[model samples]
Target: MKQEKGAEGFSENYWLENYADVDDMDGMYNARDHAHYLKAVFALDQIAIRSIADFGFGPGHLFSAALDTFKPYRSLGLEPSASAFIKAQTVLKRYQPQLLQTDLASWCRDSSQHKRFDLGICTSVLQYLNDQELAAVIPTLALRVKYLYLTVPTAAEQQRFVEEYQFVDQYAYSRTRQQYRELLSPHFTVVSSRLLESKQFYNDQTSDFTEDLFRF
Candidate 1:
């Protein structure tokens, strides 16, 4: 939550102020990303999950697919962003209306209150965290969730962040696949992982967004 400049340094507040407003919340960009994540979730044994927790559920748009596809006993979207929280509530009224507005640290600390969710997800959100945050958050989630789904930028993708877009404080580290495995090995088994390469069109050129999904 601290504000600073450089990679791994963007405050949650900065993101909130800058990205709160958007014309289309769910469009081509989001849809493509969502498709990959949804595929990862579908690979799991759906019968094992009674409820789902979208750990970094921004605007809760992605949870819409889970609600429709899994039909869990219940679904909860957690977001620390007040604006995102509010928007998620409004955006997903017909989907999973109940959302828990608390940061990951707080949510994990009070796991007894959220002991029932069988699945936990944090997609496209880890790139903002620094090494410390990721270390603290991952194990906590592994303990609480029987299954976990997450996405993060690859090392190559991290390098492409424009100077102004650099924010590393949010992510304690941007790790390689092997490093990621070493970090998660003590807690849960890695079920599957695959790199997702996507293309985005700029004014007259194409930019690539390389992300990968990890399931534990």
Candidate 2:
């Protein structure tokens, strides 16, 4: 069955067809990767973070691992893929984090929910967004959270994998590291930056990744 694509060209149906099972989601970070993520989460000491949000939280692995490191009063995981959301519900049931099956822009546009988060995490997901979506989502994220942890595949990294990897029915755009910094500089203060290597989150391969900490 063909999967439905969102307005921004993200295909929830495609992900469901390929990775309906939680085990099939290799994008979820491994134990070592989770440790690295936790270290960044705890680095923000300006405020005691009581609430957190995870954009594009596929299969809830990062969120689940986070529960062991820190307990926030409220946690929200926003995922566009319905199948991934379903798997997250079961896998993350113990943490009780609120899971939403919608893209970030739609969630941000809701006038009813004025809730804001202390920290937001977006890992291994930004490369899938096109320019227009990035323009809308980045500002919204800045407005929604005090801080953000964003991870993306750099242009150099994307180039290395272009031959063997591609998203099904989604447009994955790559930008130079400088371009990304310029894109975010107007909306956030860069606090830290680092590079990470990971096994393919969607395919059976490996990739170089970059993570940045930003204060909104």
Error of 1 at 31 (Å): 3.9
- Shift of residue 114 alpha carbon in model 2, Å: 1.1
Off by over 4 Å in 2: 1-32, 35-37, 40-47, 163-170, 194-216
198: Cα error in model 2, Å: 26
- Which residue runs does candidate 1 get wrong by more than 4 Å? 1-48, 163-173, 194-216
Let me know the TM-score candidate 2 reaches against the reference structure.
0.72
Against the true structure, candidate 1 has what lDDT? 0.57
Q: What's the true lDDT of residue 82 in model 2?
A: 68
The TM-score that candidate 1 achieves is 0.65
58: Cα error in model 2, Å? 0.8
TM-score of each: 0.65, 0.72
* N/CA/C clash count, model 1: 18
| Tens-digit per-residue lDDT, 1-216, candidate 2 | 122334343455556544555453444537336535555645543335578788888767777766545688899888887667787788779889888888877777777767888668787777766677788877777777766767787778766655555533234565898988777766666544532111111111221112223322
* Tens digit of per-residue lDDT, candidate 1, span 88-187: 6876687644687776766767747645566666776665555776688777776666666667665655565535455333433466777766666666
RMSD of each: 10.4, 9.0
